[model samples]
Target: MTTIARVETFLVAPRWLFVRVETDDGIVGWGEATCEGRSETVRTAVEQLSELLIGRDALRIEDHWQVLTKASFYRGGPILASAVSGLDQALWDIAGKRYGAPVHQLLGGPVRDRIRVYGWVGGDEPDEVRDQIAGRVEAGLTAVKMNASGRMSPLASVAELDAVVRRVAAAREVLGEHRDVAVDFHGRFTLANARRVAPLLEPYRPLFLEEPVVPENSHLIGELVRATTTPVSTGERLYSRQEFLPVLQAGIAVAQPDLAHAGGITEVRKIAALAEVYDVQLAPHCPLGPIALAACLQVGFATPNYLIQEQSIGIHYNLGAEVLDYCVDQQPLSFVDGYVQRLTAPGLGIEIDEQAVRAADKRGHAWRSPTFRHPDGAYAEW
Candidate 1:
């Protein structure tokens, strides 16, 4: 049996943390557990997790997860959970490669054949949104998600509300009647604003309304769900099942747990099971690199109630970098009719271009969500 030898992390460009766990037999595995705006903090946490991994048995992933998580009394937040998530992914990669099987196969095989996916359109603007939606449709995507509004006041003006409505209206027109459109509020709206905006976007019939209210005030989610015909979706900001219980019970139409932030495969699998019990759909939130997306696809393939995937390929964040840039074999992620076919390759089913990853690591950039401000000096959400 090969024991774990070294655990190394790379702070690569576009704000990603790639971890590679190498074993005594020279077998190597890769994992990406990036917490968007806080890559450095996650990197430090992964380093701490390495202490528990070095020289330990590589196959005992579940045991290591328990120790790295519960053994430390205080646990299960973004930093700690994300750190554990990355390590869990690496272990799964190692195990799957050793056995020459995909991660989904280890998880009782795939429950479904193909996984449906979605992409982002509008950013902070109400204008140009229709054009963006049309562009996504042209790129072979059947569904698209757009930011509803950005940094509105606690009680936004009627005109501001109207602008939000108009953007949704335009997207609906571009998508016609059959295609899907989901609106993401991005936790930018206050409860009062969300209540108003939710009803307004109803006519467009969004596939879901994401984070209409801030995640902490998820109790308000039930109200938002009741107010709009659109499905209420949130959970990307949430880290664990406990954080998601109330929202799930509130009868959300979709549960969007980001695999990278929600404690990786182990924790996200738990989250998906919880969502299943509540009869809510699972759509793993993924706006990171290819590894995170591949991990999401593996989980989505095994999950029964998966709704649709949110991928970052050609997204605004990718800017200079594309999703296929890091993968050695990008065919598995190729979407036909906005769905990625089953992942048949071993581990996460996508190869990491070590040279590209390493070279990009040398030019790692400090990525920050652009600071926003209202007309007044008050800070705005990005």
Candidate 2:
């Protein structure tokens, strides 16, 4: 029996919160639970959740997850779900380590030899979009994703519409007919404006259009799904399985659950299974740090319906620390021709550089998405 000896949490660089679980036999497993704009809060939440885990049998991940999620009177939010998510990932890592197998093996088995991935290219201009796609291609990425529209309102200007179309067009031209380019709406546009802009980018044949409208407007998701030939992908904002039911029922072709926010391995795996039944493709959203990426990879390896993964290796927000900065073995995440070979190592596969994590922890971040104001002084989504 593997008794949990200690549960430790680290708030580390760029923007990530990691939870490490130590077993009595000295085997350790890692999980990532950082929310993009709230790493500190989630780190604090993991500390509080640690009380429920320490000294328990490390192999009983599902049992611990039940208590962590249900035993507490309060439940279901980014902070708590993310806390559980990280712990669950670490526990799975521990299980795989204990059994001398990869985490994917425990989930069932590998569905593909490798997983395809997409990189981010920020900014709203055609030139920036062009340069970003070229960088990703140069880096050997087969797919790239960028923000579709910027700071839009109820009615966007002709220039804003043109800017969005031009950016998509530029990426398509550079990518030519071989690679795929995904456009993320980022829930930044009003429904009416989103409807107007959707068709404009459609001609360029985006790989997919993500979150054209907010998740709350998911009923309208079906509307957009029916409106375009491009696949509609969403779910990072969705917190639980119930939240995903409607979106899946909305007939969304792609499901984008963020491993950090969507209840870790325990919940996201269940979510992936649920999506599988709907005949929808799974593409876990991960723009945080390495632990999150490792967690995403573990699930991606076992998920049969997985599509391309979104990673933040060279994303714009990674101004301070890059993905491989905290890992001992960065080669597992290394890509060739746009695909990451299956992560077959025990637990989460890659090893964390503890010393590096501790040193970067000292500079801990206090990050908040930039504030944007609408033309009318109202708050705008950032």
Candidate 3:
């Protein structure tokens, strides 16, 4: 019997926390537990949770999840969920490696041969929107997602509203009808602002309007959905199925749970199942590293309600380090005609370069999400 021997966490560059689990039989599995700006907090949580798994059965993934999430009375938040997510992924990886199959195969086999993916274009304060969209088009990508606006006002001025439309219009013009473009509000708009902007974007026909308002204002999401012809998508900040239920019930067309933040493979699969019941499609939100992306793809392959994937191959946030930097073979992550073919390798299906990871951890970073404020010094969503 293979019992768990060690659990470790690494703080990788450009804001990612990776968890490594090794069994007594020497089988190893990797998972990403990144919470973006809160990597250090999540790292500590990972260490605390590791105490529960050190001498347990490696194959008891579900039982471990129950303890890691429920053992503590104070439960369910980004930090704890992120920690469990990473460990959960590593355990599933170990299970797949032990069974000599991919994680998706263990999740009840593949429902699709390949999954379509989208790339990020434009930064927080978007400029050169057309050029970036053109680059993605030239790269043979079929879909692209860009910010709708940056540092928007509570009640947007005419100029602010016009700028949002212009960015989406440029993207639609470049993408044409053959390709798709998704506009992410990045939780930067007020409900009123989102309501006003959503109608203006209808002529351009965006694939979806993401996070039109912050997760806290989710109750208003149904109103926004009712006001717009465009599909409404959200859930990057939401960490569990309970948080997602109201948004799903509120009429979100897509559910964008981050695999690293949403309780890893174990919880996210349940979230996907829950979303399926509401007729909403699953598009796991992933803007971190290879391990997280690999985990997201594993779930995507087996999820029947899967829509498209959001990848950070060239996203603006990746500074000094990129997704493929720690990967031993980049082929599993490489995009071909806008879709990644089903991963056939064992475990999470990609080999992480341990040496590279170790070296990066030595020069660990403190990446904080940029703070934004209004002209009068009031706090603004980043």
Candidate 4:
């Protein structure tokens, strides 16, 4: 029997926290616990949680998840859930390596041969939007996701509303009817604004409107859902299965739980199952590094209700280092015709460049999400 040996956390460039777990027998597994701007806080949480895992059996993934999540008196939020998410991923990786199979195989085998993926396209400017999306298409990607607007007002003016429509129009024009484009509101709009904008986007036929409203306004999602013919997708801010229940009942067409923030593969698989009951599709929200994307792909390959994936290979946030920088091999994450073929490698499927991770940690960063404020000095959701 392989006993747990060491658990370590590394803060790498471009705002990502990676968890590394090794067993006494020498097998190592990696996971990403990135909680965006809160990387430092989540890193501390991973250290505290490591105390519960240091001497236990590495194969006891579920038991560890239960204790790591429930043993504490106060539980279940992005920090704790993100910490558990990374560790849980490492454990599943270990289990897969231990059994000589891929994580998807352990999760009841693959339901699809390959997973469809989408890349992020920036530039609120019309020309930038068109050029960026054209580049994605030139790369052979079939789908792309772009933000609706930047720091939008609660009640958008006609010009602001028209700009949002124009951006989507630009993306759709570049993508053509053959390819797809997803619009992300990023919780920057009020419910009324979302309701107003959702209908206008219908003609462009966006794949979906993401985070149409913030997670806190989930109860109001149904109203927006009812108002729009376009599919409403959300859930990146939501962490647990219970939190997802209300949104699922609210009639969202797609669920976009982030693997790093949504309790990793273990909880997300359950979330996929729950979403399936509501006839909703799983499109794991992954705008982080390779490990997080790998974990999302593992669940996507095994999940029947999955729609598409969001990858951050060239996202704007990746300034200091790119996703493939820490990876030893990039083939596992290579995109062919807009989809990543099934990852056949064991564990999380991609090999991490440990030396690169260590070197990056030595120069660790204190990354924070950009704060937004309305012109009148009111706090705005970024």
Q: Which candidate leads in TM-score?
A: 4
* Candidate 2 lDDT for residue 179: 93
Per-candidate clash tally: 0, 1, 0, 0
RMSD of each: 1.3, 1.2, 1.1, 0.7
Q: Write the per-residue lDDT of candidate 1 for residues 261-340, one digit (tens) a residue.
A: 88888888989999999999998889888989989988888888888999988887676567888888888898998889
In model 3, pairs of residues that clash are none
Q: How close is candidate 4 to the true structure, as a TM-score?
A: 0.99
**TM-score (C-alpha) between model 2 and the true structure:** 0.97
Q: What is the TM-score of each predicted model, taking all chains together? A: 0.97, 0.97, 0.98, 0.99
Please give the CA lDDT of all the candidate structures: 0.87, 0.87, 0.92, 0.93
Evaluated against the true structure, the overall lDDT of model 2 is: 0.87
Pick the lDDT winner: 4
Q: Check candidate 2 and list the clashing pairs.
A: 85-264
Ranking by lDDT: 4, 3, 1, 2
Better of 2 and 4 by TM-score: 4
Runs in model 4 lying further than 4 Å from the true structure: none
Instruction: Write model 2 residue lDDT over 167-202, tens digit each, in one string.
Output: 899999999999998889898887787778888877
Tell me the TM-score of model 1.
0.97
